[model samples]
Target: MPTGLVALLDDVAAIAKVAAASLDDIGVAAARAGTKSAGVVIDDAAVTPQYVTGFHPSRELPMIWKIAKGSFKNKLIFLLPAAVLLGQFAPFLIPIILILGGLFLCYEAAEKVLEWLHVDETTKHDEPAIVEGHGREEEMVSGAIRTDLILSAEIMAIALSEITDEVWWQQGIILAVIGIVITVGVYGAVALIVKMDDVGLHLATENEGVVAAFGRGLVAFMPKLLTTLSIVGTLAMAWVGGGLLVHNIAAVGWHGPEHLIEIISHPLLGLFPESAEMTVGGIAFALLSGILGVLVGAGIAPLVHRFFPHGAEANE
Candidate 1:
């Protein structure tokens, strides 16, 4: 080969190797960040299906798609650059933002709890009211996306924290990868969950034997499952919110709440076998955090209703 051609091929190979290494780095960072954010991811998944609860079956996937697209816009378009900038220039602000987001989650959870208890007459009822019209659908999708923005902020923050040492461009690439992967994973699961009854119905009608039986079972089970998910989602909001508050509070120099949670949850570890102690302890801590969330939320709820009475009334 000509010397010039050989040099060109060597340069091309070196560039390919560099690109491959960058991809590998991103993959590893994304995985670590995603794993760290799994709890929030699960909460996001759990919280989403509730938005589509009263919509028609045909609208379920479409609504989820809308929300998913909005989620992408949140994490990628808006949050990705913001995270990069903040991570580089304003690291101190991140925890404060998380704390505020936690409060919002707590407030939302508390409002739902108050509504469930009949103490709040301004909020929507527990029974899924068939909300009609494009306007209502848009409202619901927007709300879901707004909630997603908070959760995605946390996810991106977590991911960004993991990759803070990387170059700015690399951090952005990894964060983008994490954002896309998580949005797809979360909404894909939501789509399946929301449309499960439709799949069940199809199988129940078109198949027979065990397949039909299972389909019938699914058809019957989805409503209860959705209800369970609603309840779980609410609790998840509380726990995630509370967890954020406690941890971030500690991050900001107030270790009192964090210590309190440890004090409350530490004893529970003894209730389980040694092998299960970590799992039990973690659950205990989460439940404790959730209790704190409930308390904080309850405190804020009355104030919110008093100040934003029209906001509640609008929902009604």
Candidate 2:
């Protein structure tokens, strides 16, 4: 081969290798970021199906699709640039933003808890009801998206924190990947979860023998599963919200809550073998944070309802 031709081919090969390495780096970073946000991801999946609970079976998927689209918009359109810009220009504000989002989560969770306990009948009846159809669906979808905005912010913030060592553009790319992949993964799982009963019903009708029995079992289990998911979702909101507050509060220089959590969790950590201590300590801290979140929620809910009655009603 001619020398010039050989040199050109070598240069192209080197560029290709560089591109491949960059892609690999992005993949590894995105996965790492996604894993760090798994707790919030679980909370998101747990919380979402409840929104579709009272809707007709056929509307479930469509509603979920709408919410999923909104989730995409929340992460990509709104948050991705904001994360990159904020991380670059205003890193100090990230914690504060998380604190505010945490408060919103706590407030919502507290309201739900009150409703569950039948202690908030006045707020319940005061909520505006639209005639069933597009209006109600829009209301539910918007509410889900609003809740999702906070969760998505947490996810992106977590992901961005993981990738801060990368160059700015690389951080943006990794966040975009994490945003798309996690959103798809979360909402896809939710679709499967919400539609499992329908799947079971079809299986029960279309199959026979052991398959039919299993289908019947699935059908029987689904309602209970959904109910369990609702409860779990509520707890998850409190846990995640409170954890955010505890960690961010400490980040912003108030170590009191963090110290209290560590003190409380110390004995719990001691009960475990050394190998399991980290996991036990984490769980202990999470439980403590969740309790804090519940208290914060309870404290804020009444004030929010009193000062922002219409706003609170709209959330319901």
Candidate 3:
């Protein structure tokens, strides 16, 4: 009996070691994959609040909760299995799909820029009526969840493509971890962001000292921060999408666009001819990619509009 007990302990130790190693592997992959999809993460974080805008203060947290739950479903049930199959069968197709996702990101960024420039502000969806229906909260939550599914699809695809060499289960776990971490991080941030005013209002009304003054400042800063995040998110989306497009095009066959851009920026490198040889390539590449991204994005928007006239309604 003692010998049997020792064998059992030995087996348990081995299993524990394997589990620990698997977790470590998942952590490393998650970090690497998360980094690759950081741009979409920012865009996710940025765009989520727009969904919560005009909601009752009490409903904001609940709405975010509903979206977060849907986001988990997107990762676990849909994206995870799809990624596994893509990896197992049509590995080549992953990049093509990722490129398309990147193009979508670019289009969104360009649309934001156009709106910023007041070129087509009317095209941007105005906040729907804030008034609550009999079951408006459910409707809003459902809509937000559907939106998260699209963005989460992009995030998962990007992350899955980044996994270098791992088993299918390993990749799935890493992707799952990324989905949860990013969703929680983003929506958690959203909750804090959307509630700053409420928090400030409470603080200001309740506290009667320097605390009150700070609360007022918090209330004031929140709007500016939200605007800045939205603008930065737009640019990041464009830049990342453009970079992906350029690389994917090169990956396939045609490097014409990328090469042409490099040639265009080859002249404006730097004053120092010596340093220009080194850093000029990178700087030039980034600039050209960004410009191309904006152009590509702008081009796609009209096609999207032609297909889906009422963007808000279509999305709903």
Candidate 4:
């Protein structure tokens, strides 16, 4: 009996060790996947604030909560399963889907640019009015969720692509963890950002000295910050999307865009010290990719608009 009990304890200990190692693997994989999707995460963090702008301060958090819930649904209920099944059953389709998603991102970014330049007629109308009346909140939440779905799909796909050697269930778990972490991080940041002005106002009016000055600074800086984030988000979407297309094409033996990046980056390589060379090259590559993405998007926009005017804005 004593020997048998010892054997059972040893078996339990072994099981515990295996469980721990599996968890560690999942953590490392999740981090890698999350980092791979960072560009989209930034774009998401930047995109969400626009939804809350001009709303009543009281409604801001609630609206964000609603959006967060929708985002969770988008990732966990819809995207996660789809991504897992795609990887399991039809791996060849992965590249095609990624390319299509990248093109969609490019198209969305280009459409925004057109609107900014007044070349798109949709920019002329006022954004849907912010009202406390019935259905207004639902309209805003629904719109935000629709946009989140694409971004969430991209995030999950990017995450899924990075995970190798894991079983389908393991990959799904890693993706699920990633989805949850990103949604929390993005929405939490958005909540803090949209309310900073209110915080600043309170500090400015209710306090004094450095606190007041800081508050004043926060209030003044937010608009410029939002504007900058908007531009960055657009550029990031283009760069990431363009890079995806370029790399995937290279994977299949066409290397034009890849070679162009190396060519563009090569000259500057010698300009920087060895340590900074990689950084410089990366920037050069990203810049070229972004430019290409914008051009591709712009070229496609007219065709998309002619046939699918309504779909264009939704994709954007």
- The model with the greatest TM-score is 4
What does candidate 2's lDDT look like per residue over 1-316, in tens digits?
6999999999999999999999999899989988867767877888788678778888989999999999999999999999999889878887888788789778877777888889877446532332358888898899999988878998998787678778889889999988888889989999999899988999899999999988999999987986777677778778878888988898999999889998888978777799999888888887888889888998998889789988888665
Q: List the residue pairs that clash in candidate 4.
A: none
- Candidate 1: give the clashing pairs: none
Models 1 onward score TM values of 0.81, 0.83, 0.87, 0.91
> How much does each candidate deviate from the true structure in C-alpha RMSD?
3.6, 3.4, 3.3, 2.3
lDDT of 3 by residue, 1-316 (tens): 9999999999999999999988988898899989878888888888888777877778888888888888889888988899988887888987798789878888888888888888755455665667665377787778778778888988888888788378888887888889889988998999989999999988999998999998999999998999899878887788778888988888788899878877787677655587566787776776677778888989988788778767624442
Misplaced by over 4 Å in model 4 are: 114-129, 208-210, 273-276, 314-316
1-316: candidate 4 lDDT, tens digit per residue: 9999999999999999999999999999999989878878888989888777667889999999999999999999999999999889877777777788788878877877877888876534566465684387787789899999989999988788788468898899999999999999999999998999999999999999999999999999988888888888888888988887887777667999899888878988998899998788888888998888888888888989889977765554
lDDT of all predictions: 0.84, 0.85, 0.82, 0.86
Candidate 4 or 1, higher lDDT: 4
Candidate order by decreasing TM-score: 4, 3, 2, 1
Q: What would the per-residue lDDT of candidate 1 be over residues 88-145, giving only the tens digit for each residue?
A: 8988887788788788778777777777898876676477887788998999899888
Clashes of each: 0, 0, 0, 0
Q: Which stretches of candidate 3 lie over 4 Å from their true place?
A: 1-22, 125-129, 264-284, 312-316
Which 10 consecutive positions of candidate 2 have the poorest summed lDDT?
Answer: 122-131
Give the Å error, residue 220, model 3: 0.6
Q: Least accurate stretch of 10 residues (summed lDDT) in model 3?
A: 307-316
